[model samples]
Each structure stands twice: as C-alpha cells, then as structure tokens.
Target: MAHHQHHNFEVDGVDDDEVPRNKCRTCLKQNTLTIATVVGVIMGAILGIILKSTKDKWSEREIMYIGYLGEVFLRMLKALILPLIISSLVSAIASLDLSLSRKIAFRAIAYYLTTTFAAVVLGIIMVVAIRPGVGHTEMATKQSEDTRNVTTVDTLLDLVRNMFPPNVMEACIFQTRTDLTSPSPNVTDVYKYNISFETVQNTNILGLVVVAAALGIAIAQLGEEARTMANFFHNLMSVSMKITSWVIFLSPVGIFFLVAAQVLQMDDIGSVMSRLGFYFGTVCLGLAVQGFIVLPLLYVALTRKNPFTFISNMGEAIATAFGTASSSATLPLTIRCLEDKNGVDRRVARFALPIGSTINMDGTALYEAVAAIFIAQVNNVPLDIGTLIAISITATAASIGAAGIPQAGVVTMVMVLETVGLPAKEVGLILAVDWLLDRFRTAINVMGDAFGAGIVYHRSLKELGLLEQSSEEEKFQVDKNNHIDETAQ
Candidate 1:
C-alpha cells in the first residue's frame, strides 16, 4: 500500500478530521428530566393509590411527610411556571413573522374557539343528563366576605366581575406568581381572608391571558429595539424551562406528599372513592364520546384522513399529558409528538401548539359546562333558558381560563358559581374528587392537541395533494421486514 498523503484546504477552510459527536450532557439531561417526569408521575400515582387505600394502616406522620414531599415538587414546578409563560409567550408571538402569525392566529382561533364551544356544549348535555349537583345539599358558605365567593348571584354579575383586566403586565406576572404558591401550578389563590371589595384584583385568568396576549401581539408591531428586547425574553423562556426540568426530577417525593395528604383526612375512603368514581366516570365517558364521535367526525368530514392514524402517532404526548396535569408544560411534548410521529410539518406544529395551549382548553371547556350543571343540580339551582345561556357563555369563558394549568377547572367552576349566585365555599366540595377527574381531562386536552395537529396536517396535505389511499403499504413492508429479521435471528 502506498503511503497516504495529508490533505489540506486553507483556501476553502476544510479539514478532514472532523467527526460526528455525541450530544451534550445538557441535552441528554433534558431528555432524562422529561422522561423522569413521566416515570415520576406513574410511580407517584401508584404509591398514592396504595397509601390512600391503606391509610388506616399507615402512620399519620408518614402520610404527612409524603404529602409534604409531593407538595415540594409541585412548588418547584410553580417556581418556573410564571416566567416561562410570560417570557415564552412574549418571545413566541414577538418572533413570529407578522403574516404567518396572522395566518396561524386565524387557524388557531378557528380551531380553538370552535372546539371549546363544542366541549362546553357537550358538558352542558352531560351535566344535564347526569344532574350530579341536584341531589347534594348546598355546602357551608364562606363566613368571610369576598366578592369572588358570590353564591347567590346570577350569571350576569359573574360576567361583570370577570369583564376586564386590571393591569395587563401585573396581572400576568402576579397570576404566574400566585400560582407558584399553590400545589397546582395554575391554582387559584383563594385568600383565607377576603380582600376588601374596593381592592382591585389582578389574579383573574381571563384578564391575565388577555394582557399577555395583547403584549405578545403588540411586540410584533414594536420597533427594532423591541425585537432585541424580545430576544432576551426568549432566552429567559429557555432558562425557565431549564428550571422546570430540574424541579420535575424531584417530582416523586413531591407526589408522595400530595397523595398522602388527600388519603389521610378521609374517614371512609371507600365511600369518598365511590363518589369520585361516579364523577370520573362521568368525565371519562364525556371525553371518550367527544374524542371518538365529535372530533373524529370533524376530522373525517373536513379532511381526507384516518383519525386512528392521528391518534396512534400522538401516543407519547398523550402519555405526557396523562402524567402532568398542566397543558403548558405539555406543549413541547405535544409539538414533538406531532412532528416526529404524526409527520406534521414543524412550522405548523410550532405555530399552533403554544397558542393552543394558551387558549384551546377544550378539556376544561367540557368540564366547565358539565360541572356547572352538576353543581347547579347539587344545589337545586333551577336553570331556565336565560340561566342556561349564561351557564354556556360564562362556562366557556372560564374554560379559556382553564389554560391547561392545574386545578384550573375548579377556579373556573368558582367563576361559574359566582356567575350563577352559588356560594364559592361550595367549591371545596368538588376538590376532593377533582384530582381523579383532572387526569381524564388531561387525556382529553392532549387529544385536543393531537386533533388540532390532525386538522393542520389534513388541510396542508389536501392543499399539497399528498393524501392517498393510506399508509398501509409502507407499514406492511416494515412489519414484514421485522418478522423476517426475527425469524432469521
């Protein structure tokens, strides 16, 4: 063999020794954090089930310790949530090209509002049929004075109360901050002593969202300097996610506490569980029917695609949603699910999901409608035509407030109750059962994310004439090759 001669290209700045490299530890750690979140959720849920069921056999201190640990994980999540929302939102909307943003916005709104409206309507139907709230006695009202606790008003007053934002920037920042203090990242901070009615509050979700959306939208119209400023916020968003990932790693311990606490206080866990079962069953049936019948029907009717393919491709996202009750946290996973599995173009997935996470709370919408009626029935609050209309509208708006955040529906329920003159204190009655229902709602929320992806993909495919008979041929080939390889081995 001849001796090899070295090659160099100073002019072209070429070097032959460059080699493919492994990913950095940060990326690997990011992945670990993500996967760990799912694992923690599963393990925590399992441990919680056992502890809750065997509460009598366990020490009170043990349960409390676990509960506190779970709470700690939740707190960590909250720590990152606010800045993440504001910064990511500001950057996302700010960075979008104006025309594309408009296009995305139009499509996003069309999909989100329409789906949420459908969910609310479905909720109304389920709650009406089940009448969960009708039989239960009205719970004790809050002894303290709080306008938010209005239990005896109609929907009109709640509408008035929620009509406007106080201070846009402050609202979003404070909302983010307030949610941080709760076990739920997006929890409503119902103060023990009510603030003076004269004091203006900025914790309203609608107002906060509105403010964030406005500021975000406004950034695009800002001068060049603002764009530079917006870039900084983008950096902040990334930092926030980093923090969130770190918090998620310790989730197992935090989850233990949350589960332990709930199980600890119950005198007859079985009876409480029976009620929870009924509530969860109601929510699950509603979600299943909506996903299978309604959304799929929309997909089939509107575009040429197999809905089953869409759902199958979104498995990982659904898994993530099942574990983390927050839709915002699930956004990155949802987009990845669509791009990597569903074959959705990144442009659409990226453009659609963040907005969807913000406003497209189809799962919460369903809960609100269903819950409003359930609570109404439980309280024996009769609903005529006007009240029903009020229920539908207020519930729909409150659903917007649901924001894929934690226990968001509960606060929304309070919004509905305050709208319909029900005592806010009645809100706690639903809390005990809310956790189980929250899981199903999360599944549906992910389903909605997947559905939106399907809609976007279907439309794009049709526009490009890419729709064909099916993907079965390639799938068949892959299956056959796998089988042959297995036999050879």
Candidate 2:
C-alpha cells in the first residue's frame, strides 16, 4: 500500500521553519498556565487557607468586600459569553457556502450529539459506581428556598419551548424567574430578581443560540443583500473578543477573591474537600475517557488515521484551550492547527468549530450530568431510570447553550438541576473547584472540535472521491480483482 502525504493548503513553503511560531509556542507554554492565573490561584488558595486557619487575621466584612468585587469580574465574563457565541456563530454561518455549510452542519451536529450523549451516559455510570455524593447530607440540607420541580413531561416541554424565544432581547438580556408556589408569580418578586447566567441569573442562552442561528441562515439566504449584516456580526465578534481580552486581564485578581471567599465560607474545609475531591475525580475520569479514549478512537475509525498523530498535531490547540479555558477564544489557534498541522479542510474547521464552541460541549454535558446527580444523591433524592433518562436528555439539551468560556459550565449546570427538582443554588457547592476543573473540560471541548473537523474533512474527501480506503481493504479488493483477471485469461 502506498502512503500518500496530505498537503497543507494554508502553508506554501512546505518547510519546518515556515510553521507558525505562535502555535509552536502553544506546545511550549503547556507547563506554564497564564502567569496571572497561576499566581492568582496559588495566592487565593494560600490566603483562603490562612484566613480559614486564623479568622482573627481577616474579617468577614473584608472577605465579603473582596468577594463582591470578584463577582463583578465574573459578571463581566458572563456578559461576553452571549455576545461571543452569537457574533462568532452568526458570522461563521453567514460567511459560509450554504450548500457545503448545510452538509457540514448536519455532520457536525450528529457527531456532537453522539459524543455528548455518550459523555452523559459515562457520567451517570461514574456517579452510580463511585457514589461520591451519597454521604454529603449537609450540602443537600442547605438547599435554597427557590428550588423548583417540574414533572418529567413538563421538563421536556419547557426545554423545547424555551429554545425558541418570543423576544430575543429579553431572552438574551433578562431571564424569567418562575416561583413554583404562585399560580401567577408575584410581580414584585419577579421584578426584584434579575439573574443573568450566574447566581440565579437567567440569560436563555439556548434561545439566544436559536435566534442567532436563524438570523445567520436568513442572512446567508439574502446573498449580496446580506453583506452589511454579515459584516456587522463579523465586526461584533471582533469587538467582543477585544472585550474578552480586557476582562481576562483581571482574572487573576478576581479568581483570588472568588476562591478565597468560597473557601472561607465553608465551615469545614476538610469535609468540603473530601466531597469535592470525589466529584473532581469523577469529572476528570469522564473527561479522560471522552477526550482520550473515545474521541481519538472515533477519529481513527472514521478517517483511517493515526490517532497519536492527530493528538500531536492538535497539541497547540489543546494547550491553548487549557490555558485560556475558552474554546471560543482559542478558535483562531484551533483553525490554524487543523488547517496547517492536521491538513483539515479550512471550510470544515470554519463551519464546524464556531458552532461547536457554543453547542458541541461533550465535557460540559458530562459535568452537568455528574453534578446534577451528585447534588441529588447528596440531597437523598432518589432518581429512578426515568429520571436519569430525563437527566441525560436535559443535560444534552442544556449543554447546547454552554458558552465556550471558563466557568460557564457552572451556569449551564443550573438548567440540568432545575429539570431534576434540584435548586440552582446548589451550584455554589461546586463553585470553588469549578475554576480548576474548567481547564480540563475546556481542553476536552476543544479536542472534540478538532476531532469533528478531522472527521468531517475526511467525509468530504470521500464524498468527492478523493479519500483512499484503508490499506487492508484496498489490498483485499486488489487481490479479488487479480483472481478475477486470472480466471478470465
């Protein structure tokens, strides 16, 4: 069998040195997280422990002030989540060739659903096997008064209804707060509660995604008439990215206070650590299975390519995702790695990843399922097969709205909890470790995106009659052909 070399369309030189240095630096930078992030996390953990060990040195009022300021930084990150998803997705869609884009979109969605569903099932299995939340009764007892439950039937109905927003502005900017007790929720209570995506904040991200995608499709249909709209979204994406950069500069300071406050609030750091440690171990295990075992195997089976080579090629993108904890922010690097390093079609990467950043969140889906069930287990809420099935569905659906930014997993996990009669406030239980686990999930999410690009590019090649069959399959065919020719002769 002849081994054929794939050409990198993005780079003409065909030389090692011609490879981009920025991406090369990605691999080198792996051991070093963003300097500020490392400093902040380290200092925050130390300060939190010190404050915990000696309360006389730090006042609760001072901690509260620090936490309040830190929250402002979190809110800034949340504010960018929606704009980034919408603008990037809309711009990517509008800029694509509709016929090719539709094919790639279908494949991407199918692949995403398959992987996300698998991730959820894996999470459920892990939670059941490990039973990490079984003994954490205290955490469950602290459930907020706002905990609400809907029937399994209503849960499905609400998910579908919420996906299509009646008012896009309200959906993106303001979320509806439902008071389960009242037939008509009290007007004052509704007016008083303004939850964005964090801390009971409800920005209907799924609805926003639907609206953005629909607008993108509409703009694409307009052909030349849509130029201005397409350009507007492109520009908006640029502006949102710039804002994200400025916000990221403050992450170290914000993370320090956020971690310290969460730590200080825990009455028993030892107990908290034990429970969170189990949960963390479960999440990391799920991520490893999905990112390492499942996705790579899938790529090998689909493309007849060496999975190790694929990973090696995607190292820079993976590192970038880990360091930034933002798949959307890592888009430029992911695209370059796929095109220049892995020989993935530029069109496939362009179409698959922008949407994947918002929707194809295998890691987030798995985490949500694990978190929801973990919370339920701690609360002693028994989940039957029906309920677990509902959780799997709800987690997959809710994850469609997951923003490709750090800590967004915690926000979207609320949807899964609400579907299962758990309080959204339970999210605070895992908030302390979310920052750390976020890097893991973000890296997995970017891995999924890169895998999607590779698989889709291979499929496109086969469709165009360009891709070769595996060596064994080709050899068998050739042997059969030779036998047939000999008999005829």
Candidate 3:
C-alpha cells in the first residue's frame, strides 16, 4: 500500500485537529456543576459531624443560622415555580395541536401510574422479605397523642378539591386541606370528629396545572387570533428559565449549609440509628431498586438506549433533589438536564416535567408502602391479603396526592396506617429517620420524572416530526399568499 497523508478540514468553523481537545474542555465545563454539588454534599456532612462532636451543644437558633443560606436558596427556587409551571405548561400545550397534546398527556399519565404501582409493589416485597420491624414491637407502645382522623374518602376528596381551586389567584398561594376538630379534646370518641375544609399555605399545583392546560387548549383552538397570547406565554417561559439558571448556580453553597444544618438539628442520632437501622436500610434498598433497576429498565425497553447513560447525564438534577429534598424545588434543573443534556424535545420536557413533578412519585409510593408495612410489623398488627392490598392501593394513590415537598410523605402515611386499622400516630416511629430517607426518595422521585420525560420524548418523536413539517408548510403558504397580495397592491 502506498503511504498517504490526510489533512483535517474545518467544519462549522472548528478545526478537526482540535476537536478532541475541545470536546474534553466542553465536557469538563458541563460537569463542573455536578462536581461542585458532590463536593458540597461531602463537605457539608464533614462539617456537620465536626460540629456535632464539639463539647458545646448547638441551639436551635444557631442551627437556623447555619441553614439561612439554604433557606434563601429554597425560597428563590420556589419563587420561580408559580411562573415556571404556568408559563411552561401553557406554552408547551399551546404549541401543540389538540390531538398531539392529548396523546402526550395520555402517555405521560400512563407511564406515571405504571411506575408508581410498580414501586409500591416493589416496596411491599422488600418490607415483607426483610421484616425490619418484626423485633421492634416494644417501641410501638409509646404512641404520640396526635392522631389524624381523616379517612381515605376525605383524602381522596381533598385531592379532587385541590385540583379545582375556586380562585386561580388563590391557587397560587393556597391549597385546600380538610381539618378534623373535636369540641372536647379530653373525650376520646373518634366519631365526634367535626370536619372543616380550610385553605393552607401551600401552592395548589394541581389546580394551577388544570387551569394552565385549559388556557393552553383554548389558545390552541383560537388559531392565529391567539398567536400573541401564546407568544407571551412562550416568552414568559423563556424568562423564567433564565432566572432558574441563575438560581441553580447557587446550589453548591446552598446545599452545603442545608446538609450541615440538618445534621446539627438531629437528636440522639446514635440511638435512633441503632433502632431503625434495618428499616432505614430496607427503604434505601427499595429506592435503589426503583430508581436504579426498575426505572432504567423501563427507559431502556422503551427507548432501546443505555438508561444509565441517561441517568448519568442527570447528575446535577438528582444531586439537587437530594440536597433540597423537594422535587418541586428541583424542577428547573430537571427540565434543563432533560432538554440540554439528554436531547429531549423542548415540548416534551416542558409538558411532561411539571406534571410529573406534581403526580409521579415513585419514591414516595415505595417509601410509604414499606413504611406502612413496617408500622404493621412494629405494632404486631395482623394483616391479611386484603389489608395488604388496601395498603398498596392506598399508598399508590396517596403518593399521587402527596406534595412534592420534604416529608410530605409523612402526612400521607397516616392514611395508609388508618386504612388497615393501624394507629395513625405510629408514624412517629419512623420520624427520626424520615429526614435522611426523604432526601434519598426525593432524588429517586426526580429521577423518575426525568426518565418519564425521556420515555415520552422517545415515544412522541414521529408525531413531533409531523407537527414540525405541517407547521413549516403552513408558514410557507401564508408567506406565499402575503407575497401575492403585496404584488397585486
């Protein structure tokens, strides 16, 4: 063979000879955020342990001071959420035709329900097999005085009520919650409960989502008349995203203080861990199976791509979810990672993510299922197949209604306990470890949302391509007609 020399040519204004170096630099720059987040978590833990070991005990106010930065970061993220959800959902749905929008909605909901059910089942299997609470019956006798008198029906009704808030503006700041009060606290009659629905200081996300979807649909139907409105929402979404990006840059510093404060606030950690170690391990195991094995498999089966690679690309979002312990807080990063790093369509990311953050709670479902069973074991309560089935169903449903905030699962866990005749206050048993577990499960929840976006994006590719082609053709025809009219004039 004759010797030959090849010269590299520039493509897209970049020399091929420097491509490898450029790629390496680009990758490092991209991952800087993930690296810093990891470092922040590690440093926070180290600092907390150091503070905990000191001779002087830390006060509540001191711990609050430590977490002030984290609190500000959280508030900033939440401040953007109302605008982000409204703008993103309205813009995403308005951009699509009705049929395509319905198809995507159906797929997203189907994926969410399937994954959540699977998670509940997996958690049941883990708790049943591990038997983490079998030997802890003694602690069950020490019950707290507080009991949630709400029934499953009441919980279900609350879910529906929150979905249709009476006032759109009120939904921005409050969600409806049913409270049970008794005129006589000393009287121990459960039937004497009086129910009242009152607004709580929480964003009615479900209601807002419903309103946004309707607005988007209406805009879509009005055709060209609604162009200005649609454009307004689209521009609003862009501005919200820009603000979100700026907030995310503070994650490392915020997370450091958050983790440190959490550690400083712990009480008798050694004793709590000794008693709850197996329970903690079991919940962690279930989350790992759901987040790592189950979700990734679903993604691979649907997309025929390496799911781990997709997960790897979501490092920053997952880390933020863990550090923040709120999927709602982590929403901005999730959307960014899905669209920018994973190559998901903007329409799919925007449409699927906000809804997923609200309803798709695989981690919460698994944790609640496991915790309910674990509580049963702790109390030596005999549970039949029917009871177990009720637990699974209730856990799945409750997880859907569960808020995307830290420890929201604790509130819903009471319903699961009461459904099977377990004491509502038995939740106190898991309170000590719930803080740590919340972070893990929140990370899994965010991962599930990201995977759902990827799956929906993969499944809707053909429809999206068709929509794009039709849009281009319509634009061409409009321009042609305008040209003819101009020439005639």
Candidate 4:
C-alpha cells in the first residue's frame, strides 16, 4: 500500500515541546472556556435551586430567560445541521466513480450497522446491569388524556412511511433544520425543546437517508452526465466543512458556557447526582466505550486502518459535534474531517457519511435500547432474549427516527417501548431525567459517522493505493507518498 502526505506546520526553529505551543495555546483557551461554561451551569443550577428552595414562589420569568440563553445556542447550531448534511452529502457521493462508490458504501454501511448494533447492545446491557430505574421512586406521572406523544403499535410503520417525500414542500413547511420550537401560550412550563408532533411518533430520518442514497448512487452510476451536479454538491460539502472547521475553532466558548450553566445550579447536587447518577453514568460509560472502542474496532475490522490516525484527523469534527450536540449540524465538520484530516477518498466520505447521518445512529440507537430496557425494569416487566434482539433492531432504526437534539432519545424510546409492548407512560419516567444524557448520545452518533467515513475511506484508499496497509503505524508515514506535491506544499 502507498500513502498521501499529511501536514501540520510549525513556526521554524521551535523546540519539539514548543511545537504544540500554538495548538496548545488554543487548547488552553478552549479548556478555560469549558471551565467557564461549567461554572455557568453550576451557577444557574444553584440559582434555580435557591430560588425554588428559599422563596415563597419561584419566578417562572427568570427560568424562562435563563432557558432562553440555552435555546439561542441550540438554535445557532441547529440552523447549520440540515444544509450541512444535504449539501455535503450530495457533493460527496456524486463526485465518486463507481469503483470507489461501491467500496465506500460497502464499508460505511458495514461499519455503521455493526457499530450501531454494538452501541444499542451496550446501552441495554449497562442499564440492565445497573437497573437505574428499578426500585426508583418518582414524581407522580403527568395526567394523561392518552393524547401525549407516546408510541403505538403502528409507530414503526409510521416511522418508515414518513421518510419519503409525501410532499416536496414538507421540509420547509415543517422546519427541518432545528428541533426546538419557540415558546408560546400553553407550552410555557416545560423545556421548549419540542421534538415530536402531538399525533405522530416517527420522523422517518431513514426515509430521508434512503432517498439521498438513491440519488447519490444514481449520480455515480451516470458518470459525466451527473458530474456537474455531483461536483456542485462536492463543492458544497467542501465549503460547508471549511465552514465547519472554522466553527470548530470557536466551540470552546460555547461548550464552556453550556457546561458552566449546567453546573452552577446544584440543589442537593449530591442527592440529585445520587438519584440520576446511574442514568448519567451509564450513558457516559456506554458512549465512551462505543465512541472510542466499538466504533474504532469496527473501522479496523472493515478497513484495517489505524484508529489513532483516524482520531487524530477527526478531532475538529468530533469537537464540533460534542459542543453542538447535533450530527446534522456537525455535517460540515464531519465531511471535512474525513477528507482533510483523515485520508479518506473524497467520494466515499461524501456518500456514506450523509446517509449515515440520517440513518446510522450508534449513540441514539444505543440510548434507545438502554432506556427501553431500563424502563421495562422499572415497570417490572420481563425481557427475554427474543425481546432484547427485537429491541436491538428496533432501537437501531428508531434512532434514525429520533431527532438529534435534547431529549431525542426519550422520544425515540417511545417507539422502542411500543416494540416491546411496554406501557408508553413509562417514557415519562425516562423523560424526567433525559436532558443530561442526550448530549452524550449525540456525540456518540457523530462518532459513528466519523468512524464510518474513516473505515469506508480507508478501504477505498487501500484499493486505490491511496493509503498503504502497514505492518505497523511505526513503519510508515504519509509524507512518503508523492500524491502531495512538494512544490505545491
């Protein structure tokens, strides 16, 4: 196998330790921003605790304002998710030749499906191991007219149905980009991160993925005729990623504020931590293992590439997703990360990732699987192996049905509960504490996409000799390849 050059420039004459100083300096700024954001969360949580605990009546008004700041952050990030996916994907897949397209799709889909399956299994296992919901007392359930957004027997069927274009105008009419809606009269008390329709249980992200993939395959199959449109999308993906990279450099401020805000308000932080701690703990453990372990392993099995190199290149994209908490929003960054940072062939990264974004959800799928089983345990329902297997499949697809935002997993859990015939009301229990876990799951979902791209691209590059299969990473480096022109360098 051969290779292509990868570059990171430094100010001349700098010591090796001093080399990372520039990058390190930026990291320090990011770390500082992260600390500040965590402080903000702490302060806000404390303020909420104090206001609720000390006063005769808490100001709904103050909660509204504070919540709004979080909303603003979500909105800006959400605003970028859809276009980033749509444009980047169209461009990425379209530009590939048929030889590359097959390799890209084959490996990407394999990585996605396998890793997703593992994530959900892990989620279910961890939750069952800990039984976070078992023997747990709870706030009384909300009054139900049975009109709430719970799942139904028909929900999975409906989820598949919704992905296709019932009407071309639907995306715009429905506000496809952001998940949260503006607050108005009756919706005032709850968090405004609205994700579901009152009557519908599924959003059919799988349908959208199917459509995009069909289009990409068609374009690739058509050759020169499709080249113009393909190039247009490729360019779009490229530009979006450049923008994504730019956005990445600024994320420390956003993350810091977001985290700080969460931490600032701790009323019996200990008790709350103790109470919901397992839920958070399980989610984190699952995501960390899936994101860092399972997904990387999938890459190695599929493409035989070094996961560390893939991780190194994908840093900016992953960081952006962690901060933004939306894969669609991170699309630009993910595409850029695959092509620019990692040595993925352009065509493969474009085609697979966009499709993966809509359908391949390692993190959300895992959360859904775990949450459903946990809810079943709380309700004292028995889950056999068959049921667990069903859950693995349903949760995998349901993750695509779920939106990529706060509380998305809970909403998707509605579908999973229905699949296993659990009382949909149990979802409210999970919902009560889902916000914190949602962020971690979203990052897991993005990692799935990043790793999927890496695996597929690695396979493609290997076939083309764009990347060599080394006996070991220590034995090879990209600079040895002539693909990167030295004069152009």
Over the stretch 307-397, how does candidate 1's per-residue lDDT look in tens digits?
8878766655665566556676566556666876678765456556666776677777887777666666667777887887787887777
Best by TM-score: 3
Candidate 3 lDDT (Cα, whole model)?
A: 0.91
lDDT for 201 (candidate 4):
36
User: Where is model 4 more than 4 Å wrong at Cα?
Assistant: 1-60, 67-70, 137-153, 172-205, 242-250, 257-269, 300-309, 463-489
Cα error, residue 229 of model 4, in Å, equals: 2.9
lDDT of each: 0.63, 0.73, 0.91, 0.64
Count of steric clashes across candidates, in order = 17, 3, 0, 29
Q: What are the models' TM-scores?
A: 0.68, 0.68, 0.93, 0.74
| Per-candidate RMSD, Å | 12.8, 10.9, 4.0, 9.5
At residue 37, give the lDDT of candidate 3: 91
RMSD (CA, Å), candidate 1 to true, equals 12.8
Off by over 4 Å in 2: 1-43, 54-60, 64-76, 133-140, 176-179, 182-201, 242-262, 275-280, 303-351, 371-387, 401-489
Residue-by-residue lDDT tens digits, candidate 2, 196-264: 322135666667777887888899999799899899998997788677667766766776777677667
Model 4 agreement with the true structure over 352-449: per-residue lDDT tens digits:
77777777888888778877887677667888999988998889877766665555566567668877886567666555445566666776787788
User: Deviation in angstroms for 193 in model 4?
Assistant: 30
Model 3 segments more than 4 A misplaced: 1-14, 140-146, 183-192, 475-489
- TM value for model 3: 0.93
Poorest lDDT segment (10 consecutive residues) of candidate 2: 190-199
Tens-digit per-residue lDDT, 1-489, candidate 3: 122222232253466678899899999999999989988888998899899999368999999999999989889988988899899999999998888888999999999999999999999999999999998877744464447587887888899988998999999989898888887878665557888887878888899999999999999999799999999999999999999999999999999999999988888789989999999999999999999999988998999999999999999999999999999989989999999999999999999999999999999999999999998898888888898899999999899898888888998998888888887878889988899999999999999999999999999998899999998999999999999999999
Q: Residue 417 in candidate 3 has what lDDT?
A: 86
